[model samples]
Target: MSDKPVAVIGAGLAGLSAALTLQEAGREVVIYDGSDRVGGRVATDYIDGFTLDRGFQLINAKYPELLRLGVVDELDFIFAPRTIDVCVGEKRIALGDPRSNPFASLNPAAGTLIQKLGLVAYLLRTADAAKSVEEELSHLGKLYSRVLKPFLSGVFLTSPASVNAVIGKGLITSFISGKPGLPRKGVGALPAALAARIRKIELNHRIDSLSQFENQEVIVATDLTTAAQLLDIANVPKLAGSTTWYYEVPQELTGSARLLIDGEHRGPVVNSIVLSNLISTYAPDGKSLLASTTLDFASESEVRRHLALMWGAHTGGWSLIAKYDIPKSLPIFAIGNQSAASSQFSNNIYVAGDYRTAPSQNGALLSGRLAAQELLLDQGR
Candidate 1:
């Protein structure tokens, strides 16, 4: 390995993962981020004895990269219910494994037996075929409105019509194949754990131009916009935006850990969950915490109206804890985007982020690992 130190820009999951991998391979790596703290998008806050993640995020235990990093065993995780609750007009419908909850199998809200069977076959086939999710699901006339649209919007952060089928299949498979859970501490704990293994990370140190470090080995692991700006690249993919609101209530509105979806697409609230129900440590002694997400900024009144529709409980008493708005939340994945391919500006410069891979935590880690591997290969390791 070379004695020269490597420079990793952005202290997000990708940057941290690259730094850790390079260090393990006997390379001295230095990480720098414009923010004072690490885990750029994957951030968490402590407020009034509650752990509020920047957005409603979770960790899929089956991610190969996460397992490789031993993250599954590093922190205490609270598994989310396999089934999801979709709020129709005035009822809540559960959908998932029938054995765990027979009610889900009997819920007519999902669709008729023929529609359900067709939906299953469609999802399975879509998993193998190279089609857009909207293109494939469009054939299922009623099922799209009843089941797919509301459920998928929460996952893709956009209408199901826009998300690539392959990405949808990957997310669905991850959800079904393994348990998705939250770390007791928060979503930030994942990157924090990775950051702990590194010896040095320069915080609040932004790199305006790569020209300054022209002679050194560099890996840009920032978000899409920032990465493009640093690399002076054009026509970068657009990103999805999201706003999450955290509320502390006197009592638990939903007793289960399952996700609650807005089936009707009536308003700003796309999905919601009682964080306290999933992890008791998320709230204080007697209070409960509810985290809800929307694609755009939702006023307090709009949030209350949506909650009232979903919960049927008077939300006037609920206390607003925090509201997080992330403008560049995720990279928009298109069918022909060169997502799986790595970008090499030169032999000593590389770009790594979720935008280069699938848009998920696994993709971020995988991209970082690939960047480090490319560097190692250059060093003849």
Candidate 2:
């Protein structure tokens, strides 16, 4: 029905996936990325003859769209099943394979009572709490007043009352239940593979503003906060902020073991470190990739100081790979909030990104596939 190619802005996983889907459906699609590279947050940098991922990036094994794209086979991936050596002060909790640890089973009542209550509170904020994860707190009623509120604040690094319930539920369903895995080559491989399928990407074409064609359509697929201002769409869903740090540790110092520390850790930084050898083959000859995730409100100095402490305490003298800060890593998905798909705005225009489906390779890929499906359905194909 339409002759004009679908215009996908943002060459992240979502945009690339959407473009590929359109191409597969025998439609012309052109993708534009502001950055010189493809993957937005899902990025990797080649430095000092080593490849380092931006943040602690990983893919879930059960991500359906990722497996469907055929890129999964092209990329080398490894499953990080072990949740061990999660340090909390004196105790090193084995959370990876909790079943393997007899201690966790033996003592159900451990740690501070606040921590115990927090887990119970989090459980109450289950998927069925509201219609959507981004639902307003008012509709949540007692659920927010009693449990959902604080539980999410601690996890997402944002207040539950402020976070949209609809998005929150999506995060819980995708992350809490699913098994998260890492890529062998790096996070960039996933997007690179996706971009490879769609050869019409214009890099360094960061669109500052969109000129809405009267009949032609444009889909702005980006962060909701940014998307709102870009498209002049109000009530664009409220998203909380997040911060992440990328660091590499020497393998001779830290072995191939994964660590995930929660809020109750030390200082303002909720530090979680993972040994690189367990995740990627390109970590380094004798060096391990160490990734640390911190909360949004945390001070940069706090992260740097704590990181130095971690490295100093663990490794006597290790090379600091890079202390890079990612102010925004993951989208804050709250319950009950609904974002009108940009692609749905017009028959010719459509938006696709991880935010639309779920913030991962799976979500990004699915959003693209869904957009293409919408186009095809419109054509009565």
Candidate 3:
């Protein structure tokens, strides 16, 4: 291997993961990014003492990569209730986390007995499902629409039916094993934690070509589009996007730690949540923060209207903090590509990102680590 530090082009989670793994192996690394900060899509914005994330994001405590690195223990994680509130008409029908409280859904207001039974059956088979998410859940007539549809729409930022079952299986398995939650500082704290151990990162430095790193070992740890463009690849996956609206509301708005998803299926919003309820640090004292999501291009007024319907509360008085319209939020990959090789690129180059594996944080970390490990192995390090 060259004496020059390994060059990681991109300071996102994938790049950071690669840098960290290489450094841990006694290999030096230098990171370059186009942004002013380390995190790419994963970021936290602070406005008027409120923490608004780039999107509605949560760290699944049980993600294999996270657990492998002991990331959960590194952050001040605030967990939401292991429950879901389905908005129907003027009320919310609650459902407990079936993994921990199998009998908690017995309350008549929670859900039907058949629905509970079906959910159990689904979880039992979540790890080995070989069908599309929609196909696997099609048997549950009302279950998908009333509870799973809106919930999953938020999860995937697209129709559940269109997603591969493998992705859904991983999500379900993680959720069942551990609760997803936010860090005290924000989701960005995750990358911040990872970046803290790195030695060098050059921000606002974009690398348009791999030729710039010919003198050093390289890892293309950028997003799918950038990776394809940099590597001169032809095919690229379509990315799914969503708009998130952050509002600062009065503390009087009644909210629980559970996430709220629309059961009526009437408007653009797939899901909404009272962020401040789960973590008081997210908002200013005596105030609360609400984060809502929509897969379509919904205007602020339209989102507010949907919010009113979903939360059963007056949203007219809520103040808009910010709106994030991320067009390339996530990429769609082949169903079985999660376990594909991250080490086969030619010209002394390797790749890492969610697009190379499953579209999740776990995949990003896993891919980056795998790519770096493979590079080290090939060098006989």
Candidate 4:
């Protein structure tokens, strides 16, 4: 290990993951973040005893990077159901095995058997193709509007049409093969747990220039925009935006832990989950927490009205606890942008954010570890 400490900028998952990996290899590491707290986008705010994540975020229980780090067992996780509910013009239809819910599978709006099978085949075939999801799914017919559009929009934080097809397939496959869940406390708990494994984290300390930390090796692990700004690099990819609203309802609207999608596209709300249904720790006793994700910002009344129409029940009593508008949430990785080997920006300065790899938690952690590995190899470790 080098005598000088490795300075890691941005205490988000990527930065923390890098710091932990480098430290484990006997390198001195120091992490810095502009915010008082860490986790970057994976944040949680406590308002009136309710835990509202910065945006609707979940962890794939089978994420290889997380599993390799052995952090999955450190935090309590609440898994969501394999099936998802889609609201098609006032009817909540389930999407999963027909044997489990035959009526939902029989619904005309669920798409015909041919269409569904075609979509599955296309996804599998193009899992490694360099096509945009929009171009790929457009060939599948009405299924795009009925199920794929609304559901995947919320997942990728952008229209499915614009996201990379292979990335989309990877996300869908991960969700299907692995259990997705939230920490018992909140999504922020994941990074917080990682941060605990490291020492010497300077909070509220933002880095403006790489020159400021003279002699110390620097790792930029912030979002795309911040990383570019700090590194003075141009041509950073555009980012996708998302807004999420957390509502407190007196009664549990959706009794199941399945995520609900807006099949009709009647309103801005794309998908939602009864947070308390997945984990009771999210809400106070006798109260339930409902979270909705949208591409644009919408008022509480607008969301409630949409929810009422979708569930066929009145949501006039639902109270908005917190609303998060993240304009630069996820990086828009084009077809050729998913390269892990190009994380090193220059000598002694490396980049490790979701943009450098896939735009998922696994990507973030993996990129971080890869960046650190590159540095370790350079140091002849």
In order, the Cα lDDT scores of the candidates are 0.83, 0.60, 0.83, 0.83
Best by TM-score: 1
Model 2 agreement with the true structure over 236-319: per-residue lDDT tens digits: 544444555555655555554565443233454454565466665556565666666655556656766665544445442445
Residue pair clashes in candidate 4 = 134-161
User: Which wins on TM-score, candidate 1 or candidate 4?
Assistant: 1
**Per-model TM values vs. the true structure:** 0.94, 0.78, 0.94, 0.94
Q: In model 3, what are the clashing residue pairs, if there are any?
A: none
RMSD of each: 1.9, 5.2, 2.0, 2.0
Encode model 4's per-residue lDDT on 1-381: one tens digit a residue. 347899999899999999999998888899999999989999888888888899998899899998899998888887777789888776777887555666665666778878877876875674545778777777666677878888888888988777777777887777667778989989999999999999889998978888877666888998888887888878777899988888887664657778888777888888888888889889888889989888877777788888787767788777888888899999877764465666677878888988877889998998899999898888787
Tens digit per residue, CA lDDT, model 3, 1-381: 789889998998889999999999999999999999988898999989999889989888788888877777888998878888887788777776656666656754445689768877987864433556777776776677788778877877788766778877676566667778989989999999989889999999989998877867899999889999999999887788999988887777775877888888878998888899999999999889988889988888888888888877788899999999998887754343345654658756888998777777887888899999999998888
Q: Which residue ranges in model 2 land beyond 4 Å of their true spot? A: 97-103, 107-170, 173-177, 212-214, 234-236, 248-253, 280-282, 297-301, 304-319, 338-343
Can you write out model 1's per-residue Cα lDDT over 238-327, one digit (the tens) per residue? 788888999997574767878888777788888889989989999998989999888867788998899889877899989999999888
